[model samples]
Target chain A: MVVSLKDIAARAGVSLSTVSNVVNGYRPVGEETRVRVQSAIDELGYAPNLSARHLRLGRTGIIALAIPELDNPYFAELAGAAIREATSQGYTLVMEDTAGSYEHELSMIDNSRRQIVDGLIFSPVAVSREDVLARPPATPMVLIGEGVYDVPHDHIAIDNIAASHVAVQHLVSLDRYRIAFIGAQAGDHRQSAHLRLRGYREALAGAGLPWDPALAAPTTAFGRADGLMAMRDLLARTQPPDAVFAYNDLVAIGAMRAVAEAGLRIPEDVAVIGIDDIEEGRFSNPTLTTISPDKEHIGRLAVQSLVARIEGKPVEPPYDVQPPFRLVTRESTLGGQRPVRT
Target chain B: MVVSLKDIAARAGVSLSTVSNVVNGYRPVGEETRVRVQSAIDELGYAPNLSARHLRLGRTGIIALAIPELDNPYFAELAGAAIREATSQGYTLVMEDTAGSYEHELSMIDNSRRQIVDGLIFSPVAVSREDVLARPPATPMVLIGEGVYDVPHDHIAIDNIAASHVAVQHLVSLDRYRIAFIGAQAGDHRQSAHLRLRGYREALAGAGLPWDPALAAPTTAFGRADGLMAMRDLLARTQPPDAVFAYNDLVAIGAMRAVAEAGLRIPEDVAVIGIDDIEEGRFSNPTLTTISPDKEHIGRLAVQSLVARIEGKPVEPPYDVQPPFRLVTRESTLGGQRPVRT
Candidate 1:
């Protein structure tokens, strides 16, 4: 049972305000009264409801994680990691799924701030840089995605450009040419997609391969279904690429399935790679070869950064957190190459 | 941007409480002043902070969904569904991951009640019927997951015993006599696990097959890794079953992986099936066959039940909610039998 502060006050023979002052150290109280209140608190084993305590101090001990898709393995793992890190720091984490709506993302920002949350760890799908900039955030927020808000306020990101370049270059190292860049979100300049496309082009030039726009498979959405559809369209073309660097693990997994359905073997018929080392990627038919962004560590850093801001600590300039990345070599991209399926 | 009620009050030249009283319709106000205040509110586009309003009214438009593991796809899907349902009914859903800990589940219950959340939709992993009855709920709560909760609190459960019986019956229909029931947690009588075991045993008895404990592959935990380890151990035995019925989709998935590694063809060699038709199951190497509980509908009901209670509506006596179930047939348990991979 929770022992409320009122119970402590009653036992101490003091008013609620007196007990509050003693608990919060908000104002000076007589030594005798303070001692009596303290003893009463100790005797009752009072564990203050964190919410009330946070409210009095202009906080709520609650941080919200706003993500685009909770069902997405990437976001699920990130949420799990974040919840653990936040709970370890004596804070509760509440997850909000925006369901890939930009306007909904904005409301989440407003809701988290208004509903007593101390901070927000946001992974926005819809809201744009202009939206974030025009409406400055009311609460301390740490964003996890490619650069969206130019005006920095604690954004955590993996270098999409560098990561994409690495993914493509790794395929080139495998002596695979005719590389396809799957999941090209043409007009949507969401940092991750746009930057990744740019990196793919750069990597092609570096590999001494001519740019082929036809090989860039455009996807309407960043999911397995989109990848499958795009890959199907690519295969229907005159010349399908021998290799693909998908948008993310989901896209890659989908594209690989298409390859299998078309009677082709992984790596041998069409090598595939993606970003986000999600759990599904590890368990897929042929384990995925992808970029691992140490998401768990990044989650921990996000929590620590938010906590520092919540406690009124000064966060340094260049408020961007760039964690290290790894290339997970797996069967999908590596099993010894054989003659391509007709 | 959210326009606060305080802004409206200032514009109307009224005190905060007067403006609140007018907006809430708690007390009568002079017609002229009410019109003046309403116009000002409309002009200012004042939106009340739900949490603050709830502080006065004691019904925050927020509910928490507490689950064992957020990383688990089933829970993630359930959370996504719950979020949608709650949002449709004008409530925000906050997810709490218990991390498969009983103590954590208890704390989540306490925290949700203590925090601003008006109600809780909980799927507990640890706390027992004794713990629950001993410390009657402090706030309106609806429990999910079978029948460990005996006391009449709002509960949402899939009839575990019946579901398991159906699963085993399906496997038996496939003309497989040596059916192994995987993931039998012996001592821990958490409703789902305990009842599932009972159903499996009952199904065998009904089939006129003598109970052979050797074919019951008991698992220490309910994850894919545990499923894999248990299956591996079962495979090492001199007499392994011709078919397997796993605890859940995740466990089934792991066991399937073990079957593949052991050079056994799915269905053709060792037919396998599981419960919880998770998305991953649909896309596994050879698509998994499993039971599909209408989790989305169940999630919606959970929210509605809590909302009804929060609105002070009298909940009926039979607080248990049992959603309909389905058996999905897929390649893993069907597809024309190929020669055993030996």
Candidate 2:
């Protein structure tokens, strides 16, 4: 049987509004009456009709976090934090994998899922800034990651250029020259790639080293295989680089595998660094050196910003947000040491 | 403005029922009429009202895949496959992380999410067969993984005992007499642990090797850290085992880290094997030897089974399913060799 507020009210010998107050906490109810209504609800096995509530309030209490890839541990770790925060804030978080497709990314911003989700936290890889600006302004959206920029949305991301600069600077501090950059995009496919490449160039110039275009390897994707293949091509060059700066931890791991396959010692033959200090980095054979972004901060703040807008809570204007990040040195850059828990 | 079926019918110069049939494919429509209605829909920018449709049909075109951990790449890879299958099947697949909590697992089976999801594909870790049996018969659920058993539902998983036996037999073939088993549960938690332990004992007896209780390490969790700590404990023993069989690839990776930290060479000092041939295993420092379960097969079948039940398709009765698995040898159990793509 569908037990309604009326049924509980009748059982508790109180008005329907009293039961509503107890169930929704819309208003203060007397402790005695709340206890009485609660008992009636429990005895009757009452469950709130979510569909009816959705129709009446125009809120589905569901939010979506749309990301580019699910296999990447960086995104998976970030999504885990967002899910925890959303659950704590009384919302159900659903992950939507866009698979880095233009069509899927466009559909996420185009009200295709508006009816089911109250808001969206998107990490776009394929869509342009103009596409985001041209989208219908029906659903509230909070952009995460350095994909689309300068749109009127609450944006959360780490400073990609600064983080990249730090990673390259770390390699320079070790007195390594001819550093190769892996996972450089060909065009305006991934915005972060452009920013990271600029940082790599700037860091080299700052260290009194000439920019060599041959040292900048372009990868079609940012994965282990991409890193391995790119490193192989770099190693095939007449003068192989002494150090490498990869797009992320996964790519760095792949490069390390390639170096091992070629029977070369790390730090002596080639030092490697990456971004996103994922857990995998901590346990890697020679632990990875990386630029660590505050994922918990980014994930929590993205959901909080979107939820605040969804509920019409007064807040700051839509602006770019850069969470803090830091450089971590490990065995990949330094010599081998005993593993320590992070 | 909300563009309704009436608007499309009016614009296309067709009857409302005809438009409905064209939109829903309830009956065959001529190619010419379908083109006319499609153009009308495109011009009007019509999107189906999912909420209204939900109320009318008492079905939500969304399903959920709930697992214990998102940080674990096994689930992430599986989720990626399920998402692809679900998208191809014309349904939205949302992920729910139970975090291996009893309350969350119980709620997933007890219609708490029935209003939002049409069906569920669950990989339970905490709930028992009795708990599943006692759930209300409302939402269609398909079980994945070897957590619970003997319930009347479409179950898909690898044969844990048989797979475990193969893992240990591989170590036996290498002439390792003292083989240790990591990730043994203490009590009733994690049913697979018991089944795997049984297989381990059976394999040892078949090889005429004495079973040593001290070598069976029990980890609180099945993560890298857990494996690392368990391996440390075993390494401190007066006579450490010559081989280790971990619960999964993650644990095996952690154990490998411990072996490396203790200044021991893989395979020569301690041979290791794990289940779940995740991508990480393929790229680890010394690549992992593992029991390779067909993750794509299990993930795809889980969604297919749940979707078939949700659509009320006529099929065979609910029964247990065991996807194929095989032993894969790599650098961890053998001497190092050039990396090969799988």
Candidate 3:
């Protein structure tokens, strides 16, 4: 049965307005009366009608975090942080997986789903800046990752190009001349891939090495299988690279596997590095060398920014936030060392 | 600006009812009228208010998949399948990460969040059968995993004891006299852990080996760190086991790392086997041997069952569904073979 304020007041032997005050906290009630009303609510199994209440209040106490890939550990780790933060801030964070599809990403920004959520934290990979710009401004949005930029939204991401420069410079310091870059996309699909590829080229030039289009291998996706196939193709070349840089840790680990399969030793033969310090990279065969972005900062700040906009709190202008990142050197680049077990 | 049916009708130069018919499909409109209304909708960016519509229908086209760990790749893979299935079934699946906390798991079943979601597909780990039984039946819930049982819900899980038998037998068939089991919980919190432990003891008896409590290591949690610490402790014993059977793939991978750190060769010195063939195991240094559960079946079936119940379809009375599992041998158990690239 649908219990109403009258039913609760009747059971608690209080007035209907007193029960309403207790439920909505519009006014403070005496301790004894509050306890009686709470007991009555528990016995009646009263769940406040959130849909009606949200419609009246013009706020749903729920937000959405739209990500490109749910299976990627980097995104998963970042999402975990976001979920915790959203819960602590008194909101439910629902994840919308775009799977890096253009239509799905567009739907996330402009669809009927926007009516149910108070705000959105989006990590767009398939949608371009123009697509994001055309979205209606009814629902507040905070952008994360390097997919779309220069929009009127709170943007949070790491400096992808600088991170790539650090990764390539690490390999150069190890005296590796011929270096290959894996996970270059054909079109302007993944913005980070383009930025990382550009950084790879600039770093090579900075180190007085010629940029070879053959060495910049392209893959359809940034996954382990893609890395394995791309590394195999690179290895088939006449003068294979002695060092490899992959888009992310999953690809780097796959490339490392391909290197081992060809009976080649890491560092001594093909040193490898990647971005995203995922947990798998830590316990990998010859633990991976990677650029560790501050995932906690990116995840938490994105939620905070969106919540600020949702609540209409004083906020700065649409700021392009860049979280810090660092290069981690592991056994993949420096062999003959004991693997770190953390 | 809120674009309503009146606004669309005014823009399309049609009656309000005609625009309503075009939007809701309550009645078929003429082709020309439908095209005119759709173009007006596109121009005005009219999003049908789903919140108000769902409130009237008393159904929210949203389902939730609550899992214990979001960071675990096994759960992530399962969630990916569940999300796809939920999308195919015309429902938005929102993930609730309980993080294996008792309070969070309880909240998922008995809180206001239940009122927002149409149904729940929960993989509970911390809540008990009694806790689940006490939940309100207002919202439909489908339980996955072996944490809770004998509740009035459609339940799905792999045969944990049977899967464990296969894992232990795989180690015994390799002529490994001494075998260890990692990730045994202290109490009845994780039901699968107890079942797997019982299976380990039964398989040992079948092999005519004496049961050794020392070989069965208890962990605080079933994670990579837990397995690493437990395996390290086991290796410090007077006589370490020759093989290890882990709770899942993450623990098994950590145990392998510990063995490698101790200068012990895989399979020759210590063979390791894990359940849940996560992608990480496929690309580990020595590809791991695992009992692969049908995660796709479990993920999809749980969503389908919950969606059916939410839509008030006739369902079989609270089925205890058991999916299939298989043993996959890799270099971790059988040495002297090239690693499978795929």
Candidate with maximal DockQ: 3
Q: How many clashes show up in model 2?
A: 0
Cα lDDT of model 2 by residue, B11-130, tens digit:
999999887766643444676887788788878877663333332345667899989988899998999889889888877788878899897788788775565688999999999899
Measured on C-alpha atoms, candidate 1 has an lDDT of 0.78
Which has the greatest lDDT? 2
lDDT, candidate 2, residue A29? 69
What DockQ does predicted model 1 obtain? Answer: 0.34
What's the lDDT for residue B17 in model 3?
95
Each candidate's iRMS in angstroms?
Answer: 9.2, 7.4, 6.8
Write one digit per residue (lDDT tens) for candidate 2, span A8-95. Answer: 9999999999987666434456768877987888788786533333323557678999999888999988988898898787677888
Query: Which ten residues in a row are the worst by lDDT in model 2 chain A?
Result: A49-58
TM, every model? 0.88, 0.88, 0.88
Best first by lDDT, ranked: 2, 3, 1
Docking class of 2: acceptable
Clash pairs detected, candidate 3: none
CAPRI quality band, candidate 1: acceptable
Off by over 4 Å in 1: A1-7, A14-45, A49-56, A336-342, B1-7, B15-45, B49-56, B336-342
* Local accuracy of candidate 1 as per-residue lDDT tens digits, A76-107: 88777888889888898888788878656877
Please report, in order, the local distance difference test score of every candidate based on alpha carbons. Answer: 0.78, 0.86, 0.85
In model 1, what is the error at residue A86, expressed in angstroms? 1.3
Better of 2 and 3 by lDDT: 2
